[model samples]
Target: MIPLVDLQTQYKSIQPAIDAAALRVLASGEYLGGPDVSAFEQGFAEYCNVGHAIAVNSGSSALHLSLLGAKVGPGDEVITSPFGFVATTAAICATGARPVFVDIDPLTFNLDPAGLADAITPKTKAIMPVHLYGLMADMDPIMSIARQANIAVIEDACQAHGALYKGKRAGSIGLSGSFSFNPGKNLSAVGRGGMVVTNDDEQAQFLRRLRDWGQDGRYNHVHQGFGYCMDTMQAAILNVKLRHLEHWTELRRAHARRLTCQLKNSAVTTPPEPHCCRHVYQVYAVRSASRDLLRAAIATRGVDSGVHYPRPVHLQQAYAGLGYMEGDFPEAERAAAEMLSLPISPELTDSQIDYIAAAVWSDAWRPRAATANLGVKSTRDLARPAQEQSEQAA
Candidate 1:
């Protein structure tokens, strides 16, 4: 079957460099926060065009540190998108701050800047906008609003390593940004890792302290903190991968363009890449009236597909006490039911992309009337009547 992401292919392509890096780290005997970690932090900071980058153990840790570094705490509020990974909101809650959610723009699948003003009140301390699916959120208006409200903007750029908005990188536009180096990400590490990037020197220093047990020096603990330090092994692996990131990102973009061209006229709605923004296509997601049925059909054809999220963050049972009910955010809820991601990793070949596109087209063109409400009744239920008629004739 065509896999959703082919990490083996990527690994094979860089096996020699990866092995050398690992062996060097093993020989060094310094496993935690070493020269490798410091070098990677500097390289990544330069890549993001920021003044500093603090390496951390995980993206969730990066977010938590950023909030604390910005002084966001109890009795404060942070605004974010409802249509995102729960980590975005969970990080806010971890900071002892309330997560105030807003709907998304149907086209970009990012936070709607128009709703920011209404969500802001005296308690609003920060706005955390997630760059979902490797597309940068509408930052121009978001920055304008945040500036007027005097609130910090923390960009959740976990999925967007090289994405650009109006020529600026995703992590550089906000006060501080968070990133993930999970194995499947564009610039991935062999194991878990994350980073926080910012131009503010004070915030950068605070993040450094927060990640290292609040240490101002080797044995001095200046403030309360957590153990969020990055592993030297992961940092070494990521630094090698970072050199090839731009080349891999271009390959992903090329695959997305080809799929879009091939599936343009089909019933599936191909994702959009606006003119002013550069989308890295981390996930090539499409929308359909019968998303679940189509996904099953594609899988049966030896193609793999997935749902980025089957439920919005606000609708999750974990956040029931947040007072959000069904239909509170219609656009996000609608997207949850309709979105499905296809294989668009840099490792996929041209023929593989074509095969996946054909599978999607074959399943997408089934009569709209038959597939429209399949959520309430399945495809098997719709076909049962015809089987009964044939049996009766016999």
Candidate 2:
């Protein structure tokens, strides 16, 4: 069976150097904030074209620490899209800020810059725009709106490791950005890890102290902060993977293009690129009215499939206090019901993608234009969170 992301193949291809890096870290006396982590931070910052990079335990930590560093706190409101991984909004809420959600642009499946400006208000403190499915958000307009409103823009670049926007890096375009190196991510580490990058020294210092339990040094606590430091082992693994990130990203893009061509007969709605942005295709999701049936059909062929998010955050039960109704964010609700992700990993073979496409074609699935305004209720509307929804429904 073709996997969603074959990390084993990636590890095998680069085992020599990866093994060496791991051995070096293991032999070294320092395990956490050592040379390996420092090198990775510098390399990642340079890759993003940013001034500083602070590694953390997870992507959620990266977002939380970045928000706290930017001074987003209780009573503040963060404007973000409802059409992303739930972690994006949850990180904002973890800081005690209310998350105000906007709908995504159907074409890019990213936060619509138009809706971003409209969501701004006196209570708004920052904008958390997710680079969904490895595509950068429309950063120019988002930055413009943020600058005028005096709101910080923090990018959720978890899926977009090397994506670019108008010659600038995806995570580098905003005031600050965060990335994940979960084994499932395009930039997989040996284990869970993430980074926050910024050009501002003050913000960088704040994150440093925050990730280390408010300590300027190791033990002396200065202010209240979270212990969210990334480990050295993951850093070593990331350093090895970073060298081949660009090549892997391009391979994912190539596989996505192959699938697009094979499935372009309108049986499903394949994504289209924005004018100047390139999608790295971390997940090649297609919209089908009968996505579940098609997914089952593909599974019969032993092909793996997934739904990046079957539910939007606004519809989540934990945030139901936000008072959003079913039709509140039409685009996001529509995406919840229609989108299904197939295999588009860098390690996937062309024949595997062809087989997946052939399976879809045989299933007789067709695009449903009526999905444009199909406002499904929040998955959490019944006072149950998505995790519970999944558990109970299953």
Candidate 3:
């Protein structure tokens, strides 16, 4: 079976360096916010081309701190895309701010910059767009709207490790951005971790305090803050991974390009990389009329797959208070139904990809017929039985 992400391969490749770093940290006896973490902060900041980076326990904590550092609180609203992980919205709500769900551009699966104004209210204080699936959103329009409205823009770059828009790094384009280093991510650590990158020196300073119980010095509790500090262990592991990130990202891109070539004529609609942005392809998600059937078939063929989001955030059980219902954001709703992520991880092999391609060409999956209301591109032309299409329509 082809694994979704082969962390074991990465782990073994750098086991010696990683083991040594972990051992050195163990010998130091300074676990939290030690020299290793500070060194990692410097390295990651230089990697992102940002002036500062504040490490945290998880991506959610990074988002939480970025909000507090920017002074987001109750009665304020932050506009972000609904087609993303719940953490992106959960972080905003944690800061006592309301989350305003915006639609996504069908092409990039990122927040639609054109839809920003319609979702904005006087209470809107920020636009926190996730670089979903490791693809950078259209920064030009989002930045344009933000500057006109004077709203702070915080990028949720948890998935996009090194994705670029217009040749600028993803996390550095906005006021600041949050990153995750979970084992599944492109630039992953052994377990869990996150980082916040920004050019604002004041916010950077405050965020460091925010993650450490708001104290300027040891045992001097200056203000009430949560214990969300990043430790030396995860940093040590990540620093080792950081050295090989570019090479791994390139490999992932190569895998994605090869898979894209094979899937170009398959039943699934392969997502294309936009010229202006380098899509690192953290997920090579395809759209299809038979998303369920194709996914089940793929899984049975000894390959793993997943849905980046099975449902949009606004219509989620937790967000009913936001007063949204079905059909509010048609593009996002359409995407939720047909989006399928194939095995596009760093460790997928050529033969396994060929098997996936062959399986997709078999009888288990079939395309849908022409529906006037169909919004998912390339689903209308596949050959599906009329009866199956009717059942799905109902």
Candidate 4:
């Protein structure tokens, strides 16, 4: 079966290097806050053209810490798109700040800057624009608005490691950027990991302290903080993986081009890579009105698909107190119903890409009556591994 992300195949391709990195960390007996973590942070900062990178245990922690570092707290509101992973909003809530929902651009699936100005109130402390599906948000306008409002912009670059917006890398474009190293991400570690990148010295230093129990020195706590340090082993694995990231990103881009070429003229709408942006295609999501049916049909042909988020955060039961109704963010709501991610792992063969495209194109246009009983499994069951499926359910 063609899985949405073939992490097993990717791991096998670089097994020797991965094993050596893990062993080296094991031999050193420095499992946390070691040289490996420092080295990886430096390497990643250089890679993103940023001045500092503070490693963390997960993407969620990266976001939470970044928000706190930016001094976002109670009585503040963080503006962001509702059409993204819930972590984006959760991070804001974790900072004791309100998460204000903005609709997304129909094409880019990123935050719409046009709606941004209206959302900013005196309570707005920061604007966190998520780079949804590896495409950087339209930052020029977003930055202008933020600057006018005198607010900080924190880029959610978790899915956009190598993405570029006007020649600037994803993590370098905002006041600060957060990234995830989940095993399925474009530049992943063997396990959960994350980073916060920025050029601001003060913010960088604050993040460094915050991730390690707010320590100025050993046993000397300077600020209230949480235990969010990145494991040395994961950092070492990421160090090895970082060397191959650019190449893998190119491969993903090429695969995206192939799929777009094959499906451009079809009924479904392909993801757009704007002229000012270089999308990394971490998730090659396409849009169709009948997404559930199309996904089920594709699965029947041995191709799995996924929905980045099946529901908008504002409408979720967890955020019911936010008081946002179903039609509050129409663009976001529409995207949640229509966007479907196909298999686009760098390890996929050309033939596999062709097969996936064929499956999508064929099923996308099939008669509704013929597709009624395509043995539809939920996207979660088809796209994710059993372990991930169980974890998500939990």
Candidate 5:
């Protein structure tokens, strides 16, 4: 079966380099906040074309630290998309700031810039726009709006590691941006890892301090902070993978292009690639009126599919106190019901993509009754993470 992301295949392709890096880190006896982390941070900063990149334990930490560095607090509110992963809202809430929900652009599935003005209030201190899937958000207008309002803009760029918007890298386009290096991401680390990039020197300093127990010096604490530093081993692994990012990104783009071309006439709606942005295709999701049935049909053909999120943040039980109800954000609610992610990775072969597309096409045209009669159990029913699916495939 084709898995959403093939991390095992990626690991095998760079086994020698990975082994050497791991061995070097293990033998050095210097782990936390060591030379390896510094080197990786430098490389990452250069890659994002930003002045600083602070390595953190996970992307969620990166967002929380960014919000803290921006001075967002309990009385403030941060405007953000309702359609994205819960982490975006979680990070804002962690800063003791309320996350103001905004609708998404149906075409790009990213936060709608037009909604920003309406959501801003005197208490709105920042706007966090998520570059969903792999496409960068339309930052030109969003930045303009933020500047006019004198509020900060933090990009939630976890799914768009190497994406570009109007030629600027995703992480460098705003006041600060966060990325996830989870094993299934475009630039996966050995394990959980993340980074925050920014051009502001003061903000960078704040982020550094916030990630390390607010230490001004050895055993001297200045402010309350939590442990969030990236481990030496994770940094080394990511540094090695960073060099091959462009090549792998191109491969993902090529696969997405082919898939879109082949499925253009099918019932599924292909994800859009805006002209002013470069989409890295982290997850090639499609929309269908009959998504559930289509996914079951695809599964019958031995192809695995996934739903990036079956529910939007506003509708989640955890956020019930937010007072959001159905139809509060129409587009996001619609997308939550229909979006289905197909297998997309640099390791995917042409034949595999073709087969997956054909399966989708065949199932999309079938009658609902016909599809139901196939008797194939939906992969979604099993609900395994991409990493788990990769291991099972192996």
Candidate 6:
């Protein structure tokens, strides 16, 4: 079966290098705050074209640290889109700041800058725009709005490792950017890891102290900080993975282009990559009115699919106290009901992509009742040759 992400296949491809990195870290007896972590922080900072990168324990910690560094605290409000992982809101809440929800642009699935200005208030401390599904948010207007309001703009760039917006790297646009090295991400570690990138020297210094028990030095407590240091082994593994991220990103983009072309005439709406951006296709999601039915249909044909978020953060049970209702953010709710993430692993072959596209196209147009009797067509019958498909897509 075609899984959404095949980490096993990815691991097998570079087992020796990964094993060696991990073993070297193990042999050194440095599991935390070592040369490995320092090297990775430097490598990641250079990769994002930023001045500093502070490695953290998780993406959530990265966001939280950045918020605290921005001086966002209780009674402050952080403006962001409601259509994202709960970690974004959680990070804001951890900083004792309230998260203000804004509707997203239906096409780009990023925060709509039009609503951004209105969302600002006396209490608005920072604007955290999430770069969802490997696509960078429209930053020009967001940055302009933030500048006019004189508030910091932090990027929740956990899913957007190499995405580019108007030629600027995802994590390098705002005051600071947070990234995740969760195994499923484009630049993943073997386990959970994260980083915060910034050009602000003061902010970087603050974050470095904050992630390590608020210490200015060993046993010298400067401020009350949490334990958010990245494991040295995880950093070493990530360093190895970082070397291959650009190539993998290109492969993902190529696969996404072909998938979008193949599904051009299908019932579902394909994801769009605007001319001003370069999408890494971390999750090649499509919108379908009958999302649940379509998912089931594709499953019968050996294809698998997923929903990035079946529920918006504002509508989640944990955030019910936020006092939001079903229709508060129409676009976010609509996307929650329709979005379906398909497999876009770099390891995927052209034939696999064609088969996946054919399955989706064929079932997307069929009736729900007909799906039970799914006269499944062989890949040979349903899929066109790669060259023919490319030309047709052209």
Q: All candidates' lDDT scores? A: 0.87, 0.83, 0.83, 0.87, 0.87, 0.89
TM-score of each: 0.93, 0.91, 0.92, 0.92, 0.92, 0.93
Top-down lDDT ranking: 6, 5, 4, 1, 2, 3
Question: In terms of TM-score, how similar is model 1 to the real structure?
Answer: 0.93
lDDT by residue for model 6 (1-394), tens = 9999999999999999999998999899988888889999999999999999999999999999999999999999999999989999999998888999999887788898889988999999999999999998889999999999999999999999999987999989899999999988999987899999999999999999999999998999989999999999999999999999999998998888888988875777787777678889888999877788889989998998989899999999999988999999988998898889999999999999999998987744464332121232211112346675555356
Please, what are the lDDT tens digits per residue for candidate 4 over residues 1-394? 8999988888899999999988888888889887888999999999999999999999999999889988999999999999888999999998889999888877778888888989999999999999988999988888999999999999999999989988999979788999999978999987899999999999999889889999999989999989999999999999989999999998998888777877756757777766667889989998877888888888889998899889999999999998899999987897888888999999998899889888977844473443221332211112335564344223
Q: Count the backbone clashes (under 3 Å) in each candidate.
A: 0, 0, 0, 0, 0, 0
**Residue pairs with clashing backbones, model 3:** none
Task: Tell me the tens digit of each residue's lDDT in model 1 across 1-394.
Answer: 9999899999999999999999999999999998999999999998998999999999999989888887899999999999988998999999899999988877677888878899999999999999999998988889999999999999999999999988999789988999999877888887789999999998898889878889999879998989999999999999999999999999998888788878876777777766567788888898886788788889889999889889999999998888999998877887798889999899999999999989987844463533232233111111325554344223
Q: Write the per-residue lDDT of candidate 5 for residues 92-128, one digit (tens) a residue.
A: 9998999999888876778888888999999999999
Question: What's the true lDDT of residue 25 in model 2?
Answer: 81
Collision pairs in model 5 = none
List clashing residue pairs in candidate 2: none
Candidates 3 and 4 compared by lDDT, better number: 4
Write the residue-wise lDDT of candidate 2 on 125-190 in tens digits: 999999999888888888999999998999999988888887788788777999998988989887
The candidate with the higher lDDT, 2 or 6, is: 6
Candidate number that wins on TM-score, 1 or 2: 1
RMSD per prediction, one decimal?
A: 9.4, 8.2, 6.8, 8.3, 7.8, 6.3
lDDT of 3 by residue, 95-160 (tens): 999999888877567888777898889999899989988888888888999999999999999999
